[model samples]
Target: MILATCVAPLAAFACRFNVRDVGFVDLGSDPYRLYLYVGDSMPMAERESLQSISTATFYDSNVKPQLLPLAQARQSEARAFIPEDFTGGVPAAVLVSPDRKTTLSLPLAKSGVSVLQTAWEALEPIVDSPRRNAILEQVFDSYGVVMIVEGKDVAANTKVRSMVDAAVSETTSKLPGLEKEIQQPPVVAVISTEEMEAERAFLWSLGIREVKEAPRVAILYARGRMIGPVLDGERLNRESISAILDTIGLNCECGLDRKWMQGVMVPLKWDRDRKQQVAKQLGFNPESPEIRIEMSQILAKSGAGQGIHRSKIIGDTLDELLTGYRTKGLAPENPPKQNKKPFAESLEMNKPEASELMLSWVVVAGILILIAGGAIVLFARRRES
Candidate 1:
């Protein structure tokens, strides 16, 4: 694996995708929120600072920036979650979760926009470990990464590592047929238990606090979303690996629920050059307004994408555990559309009875067997005669 050498740090998957890409497409991910609270009367210095910082974070990275009236912030649904004692003034900044359940409020009144800028910098902090750096470097171009988090037991770690290696090999051999344009096949990266401690922030981003089990496999794809649950013990196997890879390789339009595709992602630095390079390769901008609307429409039809609800976000740790700094398990809300169908009919289509389908298959098998038997009999008779 190649390592990233002195690359400028920036948020990688910020606004790109909140979902997985088994194939080469980045369907789209939810962007983080940055709300600036201002009033009818404000100083020009604070105003200038807010504009400069918000503009930079919005265009240059994955975080979304919004300017809200101070009065609006007071009435906003997210205000309830803000720390009551923090007492950030009207010219404040609220860093909100995609789900809007958790918020970190900074007093822009005193610190200016520097406080918010500092918080944004924390989103994509530099990593010290070489193994993780390599992952950050290559994950952008690959189908996904099969990360084998090593544990204290050498034997257990070795065993899981070998299984993951075999899975990666098998998956790679068949990659060309799956997504021919994929620049690289699925990669296998290992995280030593020691390295785990060193990069706890990175591990935390993956919802991994500790290595409860020595060897675990995390299936990562679509800009670091860890699809499905983390696997260990009986759950980690060849079948599970194939199931995930097959799902990723499934056509983006296969009608599978996007919920299964969305996973928690690690926050990595994604600079402009890399983002543009990927966009050019993808043949379209995943973050473009048109693409976002299309994804919203897809999610809306499935009743999963109508934006996050304030009621769902309860606690910080719990939300983090469930969403991995992303939104998940969204309630089904039907967004109004033209010529909508009845809910029941929209969910499924009519099909032939099971008995009829079985009979058809049985009849085809019988015909094929008869043809083979007749040819065998003819060949034998000719030879004997």
Candidate 2:
């Protein structure tokens, strides 16, 4: 019984899919249909792992497999049979080998390294298609990682790192429009088992400023274990994570958990002092919340009730509170307008003498009246004679 229980957790871990299961056959379900693309090269074991990880309630990963020959794969007709092509058009993340060049070339390429470019070249037209609305709905609902593992010649760890780098580059390059559409900067975090200290230094050299802001990149290295939390315990190394994130133009938070040859990389920010102060003022424990009547009352009054309304109400209340502080002179006053032009300066630049201008207008009007009077008198004298 003891052995069985111990083995069960391990079995569950093995059954779970990591980032590697991206390009496998999809069996309907919204998340799978939106996020994944299956290629002929995917192994059966990996396919099974993907299926196990996906909950059937939201996605079904057991659809009929469609295989295509490498030669025919380039054709639109043949590509149509692939899972991504059929369901929602194309996957957000695409995996193509180094030798298998794309029709549209990316900006930079490293020698002999595999590139996983965004399939945007093929997707742009489809996104504009009249039939693409439903597919877009699915894309918005699904979010997952794409993994591109290079074949035997490349080391497993190297392939993982290369693929992650390629994906980050590809995603970032295409994200300008996406940021505008979403109204928030996109976040990307890279976690790796290999440590690239020199690469981290090179990134900081490019002028990244602070790492917690949106549209930042973070890279983390895990030495031994393959998967776990990025860092263990309280103190997080903000400097290291910030540098890596800034290099890639992504806001990031990262930590290393030595147990899983893996590090967790996330685009999350935590302000230690701010959080502590907030916790203390709110009368709750830091790091974890201990419920009190006042806390409950605050939450309830601030709309912790339900739905999107909760966040909206809370935001409204916070805004009001801040505005109140400003009105009371607690907040610094805004600097007076520096661009206001003085009346004297304006008159000097565009001046006209008021008396001279009025006299000129009066003379012009008198001359017009004299001409009209002469014409009328000449007509009356001719009639009398």
Candidate 3:
């Protein structure tokens, strides 16, 4: 596979995606938090000298300054997480909301002391994460298997935690090949139930009460029965986790429905979001079929569009869009409207795509012709001599 390179990094960039290890934690209860760190270790004086007075560590950790490893120091460039243009030097921190949006960036201080705590407090009130929380919950719902660990017993659950992490890494690494075998990527949620005080009652309802011997283990699979793990009597181990992973969410047929791929669900949803954004921009009812159809066609023209095009659903929406655009006077100069649907739908589904055999035959035929020409010349020369 060929990778796209940055031809002119310093000059300009069409796009860039950073796939490094991004430091993330269960948002727990907070809508937003500050992630502060230096690229290299710094003395207390140097840390204190910085403008922001914030601690990057957890609740009970001691306050000291040091550089982080490649994994911990890695930052997210994912959508909503990327900060606006900031040429801030290293050791700078970013304030991220629950949805991974970078709300504020703390550039290194030139002079006077600027505590990170003050910025944290100031940004806390303004940050909100209702939408992000809902989306996260939806992902948890979709996962065929998920391991939930409590915040307090993380250290004790180290062995199992490592197992869970390994499973996740392996599943993700093999996800592309496993699409036909699995409904979704294997996922695990290492959450802080105590930090999420409100969810405690809900956990109890699901029979996962926090007792003294709380193993702090739970497996979630069924959307209908989102049950709590019975840490005591219930068997919670590597075998059980593996069983859950192997059994559920299989595609059954071992065939791909590219026209209706499960992977396109999120991007298809994004198309709706794009439609809504365009409608809001143009003052139209995005929810209306007419307006929605037009926005989808426009969305299919972008990066998100490329994925949407594969499902055939977006491709099917073309005629509707042309009609909608024409009706709204957006398709100027007497736009031609065809009542027929896209031609791709009419093609035979079972027919295999044509291979490169024809090209090979053409090359062979060319060689044969050249050989015959050489032979004719040789025969003529011998006869004449």
Q: By lDDT, who's the top model here?
A: 1
lDDT of each: 0.56, 0.28, 0.36
How would you encode candidate 2's per-residue C-alpha lDDT over 307-367 as one tens digit per residue?
1111122122223323323342111122334545788897685564575467556656666
Per-residue lDDT of model 1, residues 1-385, tens digit only = 0112111112221123223433223456565566776664656676676677666655644466676655566687645544454344545566655455545554444344444456345333322246666776656667778888887899988888788778777667655544224557778888888787556656655556687656887777765566666777777776566555544543333334555555544544456786687777666676577776655655444321212221222222322323422332222113335547776775554354465467657656666777789899999999999
The clash numbers for all candidates, in the given order, read 5, 20, 8
Better of 2 and 3 by lDDT: 3
Scored against the true structure, residue 295 in model 1 reaches a CA lDDT of: 57
- Candidate 3 on 356-376: residue-level lDDT in tens? 345445555666777789899
> 1 or 2: which has the higher lDDT?
1
Residue 34 of candidate 3: its Cα lDDT?
49
Taking all chains together, the TM-score of candidate 3 against the true structure is 0.28
